[model samples]
Target: MFEQEDALLTIDELCSILMIGRNTAYRLLNSDAIKAFRIGRCWKIPKAAVRDFLEASHTVL
Candidate 1:
């Protein structure tokens, strides 16, 4: 889903990729599960983190 290596996804971009709302995105950001950082008041997520989150999302019942 990500086209660039070493590219950072903005909060909006992350939300779009995750197909989630702003509040939920922020909630995830606040949580420890997501790998993210901030740049002058904006949240920046690495491209690889998308894959990591997706991979971690699945579990055996």
Candidate 2:
């Protein structure tokens, strides 16, 4: 049910979506916690990967 029209998002877009600072996003991108791809000099994150991360990390209080 988490289908998205766009599979990839720019770093800026990812930061906005995750509500994190650019540096934090970069850190996550660098770490294996999140997967990212480089196209030319820019990095792009897959929306599905983000969704999976969220789902896997979710915990009910």
Candidate 3:
């Protein structure tokens, strides 16, 4: 789903990749809709998790 070869992505990177806003990205994280973990005060999202989320979302729709 993403062209960038990053194992972990930051909130801004996630927003850029998904073409979504920071709030929306944070919402997903807070809701556990997209699996992520916090490193100190920063969130680290796995690329595979994002791919899985996209795939699951696509299937649901």
Candidate 4:
């Protein structure tokens, strides 16, 4: 779903892509709803994970 090869998105980029606030992004990361990894104090998220989250969220519940 990403154009770059193995692109890692920053929290700010993620927030922009999802049109969500920092609090919601942190909640998703903390809640494990969106898979991500930490490098030191920064969180790095995969584009695939965000795509997956969007796909999952669109499912009828």
Q: Which has the greatest lDDT?
A: 3
- Provide TM-scores for the models: 0.83, 0.80, 0.90, 0.89
In candidate 2, what are the lDDT values of residues 1-61, reduced to their tens digit?
2365877888888888789999998898888578888889899888887877677668531
Q: Summarize candidate 1's per-residue lDDT along 1-61 as a digit string, tens digits.
A: 5866758898888888899999999998889567889989999888777778778886521
Top candidate on TM-score is: 3
Tens digits of lDDT, candidate 4, 1-61? 3787767899998999899999999999999999999999999998989999999999945
Cα deviation of 45, candidate 1, in Å: 0.4
Summarize candidate 3's per-residue lDDT along 1-61 as a digit string, tens digits.
4666768999998999899999999999999999999999999999989999999999999
> 28, model 4: CA deviation in Å?
0.3
Stretches of candidate 1 exceeding 4 Å from the true structure: none
lDDT of 4: 0.92
Pairs that clash in candidate 1: none
| Candidate 2 deviant stretches above 4 angstroms | 1-4, 59-61
Q: Rate the local accuracy (lDDT) of all candidates.
A: 0.83, 0.80, 0.93, 0.92
Q: RMSD (Cα, Å) of candidate 2?
A: 2.7
Query: What's the CA error at residue 53 for candidate 2, in Å?
Result: 1.6
Q: Model 2 Cα displacement at 1 (Å)?
A: 13
